[model samples]
Target chain A: MATSTTRLPRAVDPNTVNGWGVDADPRNDPTYPFRDRSREDGPGMAWQRPPLQEPRVEVLRSIEHSRLPAVVGTSTPPKGLSGMIRRAAFRYSESDWRHWLMLLGADRINVVEGIFEDLARGRIPNIPAEMGARAEWRHNKLGLVRKVAIVAAVSAVAVALLRRRGRDDW
Target chain B: MLAAEYRGPYRMRAGRKRMPRIEHPRDALVRVTRSCICGSDLHLYRGMVPDTRVGMVFGHEFCGIVEEVGPEVEKLKPGDHVLVPFNIACGQCHFCKQGLFGNCHEANAEATAVGGIFGYSHTAGGYDGGQAEYARVPYADVGPTVIPDWMDLDDAVMLTDVVPTGYQAAEMGGIQKGDTVVVFGAGPVGIMAARCAWLFGAGRVIVIDHLHYRLDFARRYCPAEVYDFREIEDMAVFVKKQTDSLGADVCIDAVGGDAAGSALHTLFGKAMKLEAGSAIALHWAINSVKKGGIVSIVGVYGPTGNMIPIGNVLNKGITIRANQASVKRLLPRLIEHVQAGRIDPKALITHRMSLEDVSDGYHIFSAKLDGCIKPVLYPNGGQ
Candidate 1:
């Protein structure tokens, strides 16, 4: 088992962080002094509207909204096979089960794509390590052995049936 | 009005937004004073949560002063300082009547799972969050509680989510006297869960996380036994060894979907977008707990299935209790706990930035930068 010998980052100094004690001063605290309610009375829903944010990335909008809300998430824009499925999913209303189910299906496909991508990169993905199988084997050795045996037996039977079918065709 | 905008995964910006108004008769427009970047918000920020449209304001934990009240508003008037519950529940619903405010039926009629949540995505009922200067709070008479005279503003905001959620995590555990409780993920909720476990009569508390800073913070704040899961070769075995090879009585999954430690779970759950988030912590929790023990989950996962070890759960006879914390239901007892100084919710807050720096706040919190345990935003400018 390869243990992480890399040193973890040391704990940060609170004093060095920005905005560490912004509320420490009693004079600065709006609710301080316990008796004063003066700051609470100063503003009452009056303010200048912020400018609209220009969308830098293709933002996915729900069919329910007439227009886009004031802001949207731009991160992880649709890409790959999963992205195509996500784009299709967005075509339907969110309230529809198809929309959600398609997204779930896309997620599973995305995993397979990721494994293929890993393989394409000349990286042999450690299936057991990734799946925490080593720990599973250590903690539940009997269960792991039973599961492997069942899977092996099923594979052998399926292979034997296919071979028998080929022989019968000949 | 200035507000934090969700630009995309790993992105946030302090942008200009329209000031909110009372759209419903039960609505109260609140001028947000203090808001927080909750750990759950990271799921939405990471684009792991479904229906999290762009342009949504992301904040569920906040406190403010009521600026205007609609005609039907009776319990609260303008100029009242209040802490808002994260769950946007309509108090009249059957679930609410039963004190299950997190599952309020009418709040998010589109979903069968969770009630409406502020600053969460449309799946949580498209309510703009209080990360802005002003927010329209519906069911005004039901959710917002007046901040007590003696409570600090910082402490009041913590009650909105972290404290209550953590307390409820322990409450859901069915923790008994001298039971060894192990909590996974040392985020604020996990830290609070570990702290609250003591309140629930747990004999021992242990918190697991990969971050050194967080583990250090958990040691000081939760004051519980802390370990880096990275250093431990096998988490379940380590946990069992700690518990005299009998396993812990209660295990809490505070990490939820974004849990690390398994390359496979990270690939399938996070990077590949297969499951809501990683179920590694949950798997460990189920595997680490003693037979007939309880596994309490407060960590937020998408309303989808994960690769959970249900077989182990059934074989071990583990009682699994999970939910979005019924914040309103837990608030009363939590308020008392806060007031009594049994828990210092404010000590957990390490960063306080103005609403303009909210993007930085989210960045700091998300990256776990500058040793930030909790980051609060002053939307209407500090205090």
Candidate 2:
């Protein structure tokens, strides 16, 4: 006894069907399943509660005024101790040093390319006198190639910890 | 102009395109008027999402009208009717000024994996979605909204993403006053996360699935307790033998990574893609919650990781929580839980077709056939 069948392929078009348009509106199609006409069974919500978290108290009052402290005043010059030892040895976060200098390929973010070339030469200056002379010539050529790659990685980790303390002083 | 067309894995096709505009100054466009078909677009229609781009156009929830707005759009105009929110935020970023609009650090160029999800492809911010008949909308007054005048564009297109991803999967399952909760996928975001876990006072909710028509449509639309984990054979020991084993204080995993009864997890996550599909309902919500429970996870995995057990979520002291549903910070308490009738996101739409039969509504919703749960799609030039 054998009985086999396989036909499926004509993906669509039984005359494009076209009926449930505004997602069914014969007054919302006899309310087919609007959870059996709710408002907990009537009066379509004569205001009984809900809506108080007023958009979570206006998004926590705009995240408490965007965590305050940025009243827009920055004319550069206040980083004394060699810019706090280069912000504590480049410990990142200006959006993680612009995504780690754009994953090391350096997508040129000298403060967003000196604020888009000083707003395309119309100058809205924060520190743009040729953006502090091309950011002091790209921070003195990236601080002499990051201080010679951190003094050649701390002199190859202090010569492998002094050759393991000179073989434990032999 | 018809649309949708991915062309590969479980192929989608639809045809005629090109008609979107205003590429930026905070673009707008829209005109879609309803578009659904999300279960995270079946993880890019089963190729299991990862740079899914063969002319992509899947729909990320949807709802429309505005039809043009860009010179830096000031809160929508030309004919309004909005509803967007499938996270593409950028209202001056630090995560959309901390309402964490789904982590929008300038709308996803993989904002460190996931943040811009419209048509769920290009790992989510390659834009292009609203399954067609127009849709551009980036940042347009921080993710659409409008649709109020007494709602119902089928309940504002399930408030753009299955009722704020099933009300943030029962508000990240904190579910206090009676907490038992359970969930796992019965699908329209697990019947709105078991009807928002009875508005978070769940003394017991349940759900599970293996489909007896989505456990009889989450037992007539959720006040929970539906089952059929293929008639349980150790579904985390039948949910800790129905709770007294001190389990379920909350366990969500609304079925991400295409989970299904394991046959070595559909032969290694749907035929050897390695991982990111068969997490088997996050390994049965980290082995059926309890010892310090609270799982949550509004499902849709595959930005690459997932084979999770994490030593049963660190020895079941669980807590987890998950995201992608910040839908403009839960749209004014889900439009006042749909105008206080208390949640009726269009009774989870059963089916409706025509954006020129969107490839037969994505082949009867990726072949679950007739008892399909949510479908909706319109866009035949706004009918």
| lDDT of predicted model 2 | 0.65
Root-mean-square deviation of every model? 15.4, 23.4
DockQ of each: 0.02, 0.01
Candidate models: Cα lDDT each: 0.75, 0.65
Clashes of each: 14, 2
Q: Write the per-residue lDDT of candidate 2 for residues B1-383, one digit (tens) a residue.
A: 67775554555666666776665566688889789988879777766664454456778888888878977678888788898988877655444554667766455433344677777754455567888888777768888988889887888988888888887777777666455678888889888877776665555577888888878878766656688887788888887767666677778988888878887776777777566668888788888887767788888876445576788778877877788788887799778867876778888798887776666666566656668888988885544
Residue A159 of model 1, lDDT score: 100
List chain A TM-scores, every candidate, in order: 0.61, 0.17
lDDT of 2 at B240: 75
Number of the top TM-score candidate: 1
True contacts kept of 1: 0.00
Model 2 chain B, poorest ten-residue lDDT window? Answer: B105-114
| Most DockQ-accurate candidate | 1
Error of 2 at B142 (Å): 23
Model 2 residue B57 lDDT? 78
